[model samples]
Target: MKLPVWKEGLAYPQPSEMSYPGGMTRILAHDGRRDLLPFLHDCTITSHEGRLYLGWYNSTDAEICGSSLIRGRYSEDGGESWSEVFNVVGEIGSAEEHFVPASFFVHEGKLYSLITEMGGKNLSISLDLFQAPETSLDEWERVSVLSGGFLSNSSPIPMDTGDYIAGVWMPLKGDTPAFPAVLISQGADIAKPWRCSFLYDPLAPDAVKIRCPEITLIVQGSAVTAYVRNDEGKHGDLTCGPSFVFTSEDYGESWSKPARMTAMPVGNSKMFAGILSDGRRYLIYNNDQGYFKRGLLCMALSEPGEVEYTKVYKLFEDKAAELDNRVGVWFYPCACEQEGILYIACTLQEPDGVRSAVIARIPVDTI
Candidate 1:
């Protein structure tokens, strides 16, 4: 299969222009000091009980070296306006801790936030349940730590048999490098032990260098298809490579060997794939040639079990020539579908070195 070619202004369901009162596109949060590098990366948005919640990791001084914090904002009027940023987790300016928000999911009538804490070279992943105080969204408590893994931004999927499965990438004890895997839980209960199954081996002699694995799963009847991002292209080329696929027939208990998806050309970055309520499968990713030059953020459509995609939508294009060698444009988009809108939260970078967390409310009917 050949890689799908994306043309400009070819998006379906034509994207609406910025026409809201305060503007459809607004910066959710940013660093106060212009000298510091403010980074808001890999945000997750969820609509629960008639309210919208956006969560992401914020770093003012540096991207990964300094202290990072998990912050959140809420909008009562469907994202038209958001409240002040509230500390979701982490101690502000902690010298020894760097907290990063991973994902969000609601189970058993409670909202849960997943966070990854990085200290030194070790990474600890945990979950906290949000406790709404009487009528305030500012107050939230960290209940307990779930499993200790690495960074996972994919939402957990509830199976028909009542189990839940989530994708994660972490290194095992004594392993040289980490790789992508899945966590199977008995139900929505995070307190219970989760069975861990590594989808691919990182230390295998022939294994490629995999980083920041974003695993997206689509369930069709009894089969579950996983589309995983290969951050580092196979061999020495890192600019452009095919995403990998793993299919499971036994409810994720077993998976087929990883196979290259020649139809999908993904840069060494995060990509999202999920089946929406309208039965259309959508994939949002950077359509660039490879290796961190993420300028064109696009959305592609396909059937449930099909590998080829069409109806390509160019969401945003970064025009900063200075960012050519650096991480370009939009990256790390965490998306969810609500009502008729597909809400995506991602890190948008400007030419002046200002990075922010921006939200795009895309209508699904247009596609």
Candidate 2:
């Protein structure tokens, strides 16, 4: 199906006027300097009861290199202030065993987390589900809520068929070139067999060099739309691709073939999509064409049921002198709405390549 094409990018106002007014920003986790195990990234945020929760991982060297540990923090006052950070998940990732990143979801009024673990005899990746009860927000024990097999960029959302659906990214292995797919949970229980809908085959000979997909899902009424991070750069003319779009009508049982959302610029990074309580659809991403890095974070919104996100916004950038040297690149936004504010948790990739987490609160009415 053909989707509407929106204009490319809306340049930021002079002196970066688009933010701090739209929302307030805060740096949640960071040491005075990049620590011994400095590399940190893949932050996720959500709202439950009346508090905000944030989670991320810190690696020893580069991503998936030495050891990576998952840490978390929370805010009771709507991102105004935060609790002390703690290791909600145990242990650090090693060469023989690895723990990459985590995402959050609320099911049956209870908060749950899905952490992707890349460990096995072959080091094959899988996702394990854990519950963080209301009594213990800072502490979460490793317990089995579901079997692990796929790696998802975000939390799953409840489907109309009394099920749950989430986007999964299968990395490249051997001749496989990395591909995107969706996992629709059977019934209301995610522990049951999930229907995996493979969008494209990574093993295709014509596949690009690398395809690191970060799937973002938005459910409006019965139409489940996916804004995928389609990082197809080569195998064609030299280029960097934008977010891909597709829809699932049968509650994610199946979906249309992925198609690039033209002009929706992005580097190889994660983007987030969700519908506000007021029904406006919003997307948080680094809408630049650069393939490796980005300048700042951006957001685009679509009026209820519109295909194109005409309402675009440039979020605030963390350009502080103390944070290394280069300008701050806010990437990988995971967001959820509470009351009327859209609380987005993201990572600030400093000049040195180490990362830290931050949260930006934006009210819907302000947009």
Candidate 3:
């Protein structure tokens, strides 16, 4: 499908007020500078019961001057009238170096967000889990921290038992390629002996592997599918990118043989995905290998087997080429599909220089 030149809507509203060296600043930090740190990447927009639910990172120093983590945002009038950014995974201290926000969803009358805390090596104990509040968009609070590990880009799939199945990658000690790990848990007890298992173990006696996985649960159909990349070193830096998939039938029990997705190979990282209300699946990713830059965002649809699938289509691509150097490249795509309308949100290098969030609304048929 031919991609559309992003039909820009009202840009995400800037924080009403901020504190700075001179005085209080009321500007959207879209310019790259020491004063602001871009943090609105990896965004998801879900329209439920007439309201829009947005979740993304809130770079700590975006305004006052520090590093921020992922947070939640909401819009009452479609994409207009955005509420002030609220914490989805709570706030981090200045001493904390690696706290990043990712993954968002609405299940069982609550907003679920997964935020990862990376502390380099010593901080190997990364935290990735779900945060739900009464009304998180307005008054965000960390209801619970699901699981912690070296998890960065992950996708949470809800199961029939009110629990969750998530796709994760925990780096194994040394230079071993990050292994794809699966976690099954209920509520917020990640420490309860995770119904966990490592899907793709490169060093294992088994030759097959699944890397960088993104999973979706077809609750009604009782099926689960995971998309992953086969980064088996042999691909080298060229094939070191992403384009792999794995599927599961028995909840989180076992996975089928992985099928290579040739559709999303230009150069991308994390694969953020979602399932439409009608049961169609959507996968959002970026071509971030830097060859064409991270300007392209692609969406693909498919069933369980991976053989029969919709032709990969570029849903949204970064047109802000001139501002690439200042704001960096476009990446971190999070998506939400409801009632046939698919919402794709991502971060981009604004012409002013700072990194800000931009969104695109597309019909599922367009994919």
Candidate 4:
């Protein structure tokens, strides 16, 4: 089928702005330090009581401060307005806990917020759960913590009867360097312990680079996708690599082996995936995989079980011209779906040699 053209929306230089860059949307909140640390990572956006709630990580200093916990920011008037950014984990100055914010879901009228914490060998690495405020979007209470070292980039899937199935990133031990891992959790309450492991470790013949995992439980099917990079020899090198997909029937309990989505998994370094309002999948990351080459954000359509992909179109194929190497490049693509719209938020390696954030929106039907 000929996929519909995806009309890309405006990009934001800062989070909280009166309006977006292209004037197509409004910026809800800005971190104010555009040239310093970028705000939010592994972000999840959900609609509740007609307002949009965003839970993400505020990276004060990637190499120093670690991923600080940021609270939910709400917008009732669609994308026209936004609330002030709050902190999820109460005021704890310089706690030394790296919190990677993740998925949010509501079960039995209670809002559950999921985040990952990494505190080196001295600190515990696990998933932290918080309960949202009863009325106002002011405070979030700490509920529970899941044990594990590499519990990050989690996507929670709510089952039919109200139970939740969470797909977590589980780190593996090998010579492939350090990356995200894959884990699974199933329970009625948010505090219950769930099983976690590597989703797939298929032989790549070269290297295994899987990070930024996203899983979706859809109608008549189930699917999982992630951003992958082959930095075998180059540990921190960012280049377009390849993307892979796995299928499951029993609500993500067991996945159906791995399959390559991109034609070849050799050159690309990034391939961020998101399920659209129309069931089509969209991705944003580097496409070239070549050293120093620019990466383009793209969108595509896919059938849940089918291995072959279709409608690969570029959203932004421009090189990160303003990126500062000292601060790293503008990367890490994550998307959330709400009311038939896909909101994508990512970081830009700022010109001041720091990290900054940019967000954009697109209708699901447009893809």
- Candidate 3 residues lying further than 4 Å off, grouped into runs, are 1-35, 47-49, 60-66, 89-93, 121-145, 150-155, 187-194, 205-220, 230-242, 263-266, 287-292, 302-307, 320-328, 350-353, 365-367
Error of 3 at 293 (Å): 2.9
Instruction: Candidate 2: give the clashing pairs.
Output: none
- All candidates in order of TM-score, best leading: 2, 1, 4, 3
Task: List the lowest-lDDT window of 10 residues for candidate 1.
Answer: 17-26
lDDT of 1 by residue, 1-367 (tens): 3222222233433233212221223343333233243766787777777777787777756675566777778778767777777777665567587776557777776666656666633455453334433455554666555566566677777788788777777743455675777777767566575677777667788876665566777666567777778765544564656777787887777877787765455666777777777777777777655577777776777654454465566656654222233333887877877777778777777666677666667776666
Q: Assess each prediction's global lDDT (C-alpha) against the native.
A: 0.65, 0.69, 0.52, 0.50
Order of the predicted models by lDDT, top scorer first: 2, 1, 3, 4
Instruction: Judging by lDDT, tell me the better candidate of 2 and 3.
Output: 2
Q: How do the residues 1-367 of candidate 4 rate in per-residue lDDT, one tens digit apiece?
A: 2111122232211112222123222132344363234444445666666766666666555532544666556677765567767667633355567666566666666777776665642243777777787766556776777546544443565556445555554444445434433444555755866566455553456434543333332322443433344333344466434445455555555655454443532233333455555545544544444553433444444543333343444433334322222233435555566676666655544445444444456666555
The deviation in Å at residue 340 for candidate 4 is 3.1
Q: After TM-score superposition, what is the CA distance of residue 345 in candidate 2 from its true location, in Å? A: 1.1
**How many residue pairs collide in each prediction?**
3, 0, 13, 18
Error of 4 at 260 (Å): 3.5
Residue-level lDDT of model 2, residues 147-254, one tens digit each, is 445677788988767878788777766655667778777776765556777666556765434467778788755778877776766544334766677787766667
**Worst ten in a row by lDDT for model 4:** 12-21
Candidates 1 and 2, the one with greater lDDT? 2
